[model samples]
Target: MLIGEVARHSGVSARMLRHYDALGLVRPTGRTVGGYREYSAEDVRRVFHVESLRSLGLSLKQIGRALQDPGFTPSALVSDLIRWTEDRLERERELLERLRAIDASAPTGWRDVLRIVELMQGLDSASAARRQQAVLARSEGVPAPADVLAGAVLAESDPHVAGALRWALARSDGDGMATLAAGARSEDADIRRRAVLAIAEMPETPGAAAMLADALRDADTRVRGHAALALGRRGVTAAVPVLVGMVVEGSNDVEAAEVLGTLARDHGCADRVVSALVAELDAPTADSATRICLTQALFELSVATAREVLRRLASDDDRAVALVASAFVGELDGRSAGDRGARVRSASGRRKPRR
Candidate 1:
């Protein structure tokens, strides 16, 4: 076959085939009277072979060596090709993500595009300060897309920066709630924790509350605790049981207790919250330390019902529980007496004649 025929038969273009011949990768075997290049069957086969290797991302120089060097081992070259392909694919994927983020941001101009890109880079920066600054700048000016903030929030290891990122996501359009919700179900406990924390700060979007509700059942104690705290703060009484469990476990038990107190302030949920706490305290299987933590958790509740319960607990059989409960009751009594004394003194002073 001639060059044109070879180019027609195979997908390789004529110019590329000639270039391959000059590179000695697939030289023609014969020439016509007009001195035009002519390819034998074996030469055409070599052309196809070169095209095959090229398809595998082999450079022309590498292909030349691969074709001509009998000592050349394809294993090493193939491995290298795989690595190079992976790198290119990664780069392409990153570029695609950047484009998608930009599109989602709906940048009004090149300046807006540049700002978003810069903010994204800063969010991904190794320096936590830069990440924090990025979130601040984005919040103050061009808000980053929720997806970008979501990604940053999940991967951020720094507490400060992660807080800022969550704030930014909450302050943004809130389209990233789905990403955060998916992250709440992540197999990684750390990621799940981060997701819940971020979502906890988000506006109570329809799906966010449900995601947090699901997270209350997570196997990770931290995840469950965060979800419970968030739910309690949101006045979701469904969190009462988990909040009680957190008090039993002594994980953020103070905050859990405080949130439970807030829930108890509601006349409807108040009895339920007190009942759950007392039930945990009443469990026979609860260890001494757990019982002690539960006793301490009672201090956050100042209602008359809680005081009566603490008075009953003050004389309990467990020495540690009795100590904590008695101390709490004593503190409450002292504060109460001090308030009464102040009121009486003010009344007496008012009743006295001015000098």
Candidate 2:
């Protein structure tokens, strides 16, 4: 077959066929009467073979080696192509995400677009300070998209950056509550911990509350403690037990106790709060130190029932427990005396100087 005929039949452009011939990849077997290059059947088949390899992302050099070198194998070259394609795909995905973030920001002009893009890039920077600055910059103007802030908060390791991201997320119109909730479910403990902590900072939306409730059951103590503390502040009674357990474990025990004390102010939950603390205090597994921490945590409670419980604990069998409880009780008594004295003086002063 003539080169034109092969080009017509094989669909390979004549120009490319000439280039292939020049490269010795598919030399025609003979010349026609007019001196046109005539392609033999085998040469036409090689043209199809090269096109087939090119379709799989092979470079011309690789294709040439694949067809000419007896030792050349498709496996290694195919693997390389796969890796290159994956890398390209990853880059494309990142680009798409940035574009989406910019779109989500609804930038008013190119400057807004540039600022948001810069912020997004900074959020992904290796330097924590850069990431922190990005979040800080977000508050100054051109806020980051909700998804960007959510992603940054989840992956952020620096406490300051995480705080700024959380603050930005709370202000962004994007719906990142779901993202944070998913992070709460991550198998990575750090991600779960960060997720719950971020959710804790979000406004007390129903979704945020529900996510926090789910986090209360997380296996990680820190994750649960954070969720419980947030929920406790929101007055969710379900967090009471976990907060009490935090006191027992001595992990963020002080904050947990503070939450528990706050919960104890609610008349409905005060009994439950005081009872949980009393149970832990009375448990055989609670060592002397654990009991002492629990005793101190009781000071956070203002409920009369908790005070009565403290009075009873002040005479417990363990001298250390008794001492801590007695000291707290003494402090409480001293504060009450001062409060009464202040009230009396204020009342006397309100008597209009008898003039």
Candidate 3:
């Protein structure tokens, strides 16, 4: 059989046939005397296998690997594929049900009408397997179920649909923490940020701490901040040095300060971390926000070291610094005026005499 005949018999396009040939998935059995390719009956069978694997949502690479294996069994692969398809379908069904509920409550509009029509069109145009395959393909390379779920959330207008997808994705652990961590190195900042956050929420597993530590240095401020927060939440004190570095760099300093405060409060490094954060507060180049965050963090630490830092900042000439210092002193003293003398002195230092 020629390529044309194979296309005609198999109901697959010539372009796809060429694709399979390129992938070595369905190679020609021989060549004619004139150098044209010829497919044997067995070659057609191989094409069918390729098509079947593709229909079951296997990528060309995955199919190639399975086909090359001596123990490969299409029936077993198909069964597993069926289970995955069924699970995806159930998720979509749950999402649709939630959307239906929301639709009933909301006022009907052109947008709502269009959404219903689109859903109907999707149902009319393809079988459930095809739909699931399309969805899975679109979400290829997503590390965890949560990352895919986050994408689904972004796709839907209804919160319920988004929420349902999130629930489904979260419940399914499709990939390991290592895969999710690798996604953190993706060139796409958004993907990297989401991947880091997903791993942060994952159950503590081997190498999870190391992955979090690596994510703490991510170029994206949000990714780094979330990594720090995750470490603090898990009471992983090893992240303190990295969090302190972020504080010094002024990247998401507020979040870094909060995480440091949490570390100080729950972990044993309260005194040392608080002292470092206070030193940062006193730096001449430190921003007003950094100083404010440091002040708040000191309050959270609530130790003698923190109190001393607050006292020094109270007399700093920067008005913003003085204000935060006054607030901290007031919070601790039960009255606002205990720091009043220092505040007056600082204000006088900044005062200009009338001409």
What candidate 2 gets wrong by more than 4 Å, as runs, is 138-141, 340-355
Q: What does candidate 3's lDDT look like per residue over 1-355, in tens digits?
A: 8888999999989889888888788889898898876899999999898888788798888799898988877787778888999999998986785465335425246555444434333323335443343333332222223333444333333434433433444454443454466667778776676666666666666776787788777788777777887887788886776677666666766676677777777778887797677667767887887667667667766666777778877887878878888878778876446578788999999999989
Predictions in order: lDDT: 0.87, 0.86, 0.68
Let me know the TM-score candidate 1 reaches against the reference structure.
0.90
Model 1, runs deviating above 4 Å: 139-141, 334-355
| Winning model by TM-score | 2
> Per-residue CA lDDT of candidate 1, range 213-296, in tens?
999889999999999999899889999999998888778988998998888886368778778878888888998899888777
- For model 2, residues 1-355, the per-residue Cα lDDT tens digits are 9877898999999999999988988899999788999888888889999999999998888889999999877787788899999999999998998898788789889999988888888988999998888777664666678888898888998898889888888877776877787888899999999988888887765688888888888888888888898988888899999999999999999989888887888637888888889998888899999999988888888778878878988999999989888988898999999999999999998886555
Candidate 2 CA-lDDT value = 0.86
Give all candidate RMSDs, comma-separated.
3.2, 2.5, 16.6
**Which pairs clash in the backbone of model 3?**
none
